[model samples]
Target: MKLSVALIEPEHEVNVGHIARVMKNFGVNELFLVNPKFDSKKATIFAVHGKDLLTKSKIIYFKDLRKFDLLIGTTAIYSNNRSNVIRDSINPSQLVKIIADSKQSICFLVGRESTGLNNTELSICDIVVSIDTGTAYRTLNISHALAILLYEIKKNSFQKKTNLATVHERVLLIDYALKLAKVSGYRRHKTSLLAMALKRFLGRNLLTSKETMLMVTLFRQALLTIERKRRKMF
Candidate 1:
């Protein structure tokens, strides 16, 4: 499984830099930032040996979540607001079990320092995860929370030793699926949901190189067949 960390509108540049360094410490390379309040100079100073991660980080939007197969949202809000079931979360240990067995690109989303993720973002994520802490201190800093989650991910995550579908490959497949949905007369909203669910399934299943290749071929064929039928009708 490929692991990535995403910070959403982080408030402090120092935290971003620290998270980058922590990510390197635990062997995670992909770092994504969304509408960040990032200061390159401070980030550079904090990153140290992990400057590479800071340099290669990606800037993304909430809608760009399709790139990750499984998204784990981190929040301090637990038990108090169980009424919103979507915001209810699993602990790090449970998250470890899920990632270790899957062959997908997983992204852990850390919210802004002042406030954690809102209901809408958490609702879209595949799973909401939290770390257990002392009751007196319900919250942790962004980098601290990031470090703990990354450690758990590294501890029990899938060992990548075989050929598997890459993020690029998965994106292409999802594109074709959207086209298929369009031809089948599905509405845009329903098609989007289908794309989301399908992406999770593809990420969850560990496909070998050969198996991935076969899937790509099959999706391509399906798209071609649809185009041909449309042509003949015209």
Candidate 2:
């Protein structure tokens, strides 16, 4: 999986340069800027030895971000008023585990230096990630956050063996199971419960496509048995 870091309307050239330096340290090549405020000189000075990253970086519009498969936004604020869902931000180790099996291109999105990602920008992201900071001053510099997140991601990338199931395959398996339950005359309410139970059961096992297919066949057989019993009763 390819990983890229994206900065949305960043205001500080120094932060951009520092982030580029960090990206190079972690072996991350792609850098995307959306409407940045400064020119190349400011970034180059901060980049130090990592000037090539800034030179080759892709500056794109917000609309073009759709090309990436997964977008993870970063934020520091936790206001109840915000519409975006705030979940536990994964530590570097955990983040690596989550992406180990993912096949899609991943984008790490950082908002402007002055203010973090707004609600609307956060909405486009598949998930929101945050760095753990001291309560005395919870906010981290944009470049610092980028550096830490990239370091963790790179560390995890090297060690993880990617075998986790894809979302599409899991959905297909669930659909098949639901169809089988319906054919067996499971009541609508009962079917919902059953589906939930089955989902939990399957989730625990982390079913692969082959294992899921085997379960599907077994469920079909169970449905057939239920149908035969119903006919006998009639």
What would the per-residue lDDT of candidate 2 be over residues 1-234, giving only the tens digit for each residue? Answer: 788998998887788889988888888889998988877777799998778999998889997887775677788865553222433244555566566646567898899888878866765665567776767576899888888887776556444434444545555677778888688566776765555445434433445567766766787677788889989999
Clashing pairs in 1: none
Taken over the whole model, the C-alpha lDDT of each candidate is: 0.77, 0.72
Q: How many angstroms is residue 149 displaced in model 1 relative to the true structure, after the best TM-score fit? A: 1.4
Best by TM-score: 1
Best by lDDT: 1
Candidate 1 residue 220 Cα shift, in angstroms, is 25
- Positional deviation of 9 in candidate 1, in angstroms? 0.5
Candidate 1 residues lying further than 4 Å off, grouped into runs, are 80-82, 157-234
Residue-level error in angstroms, candidate 2, position 112:
0.3
Q: Show how many residue pairs clash in every candidate, following the order shown.
A: 0, 0
Off by over 4 Å in 2: 79-88, 157-234
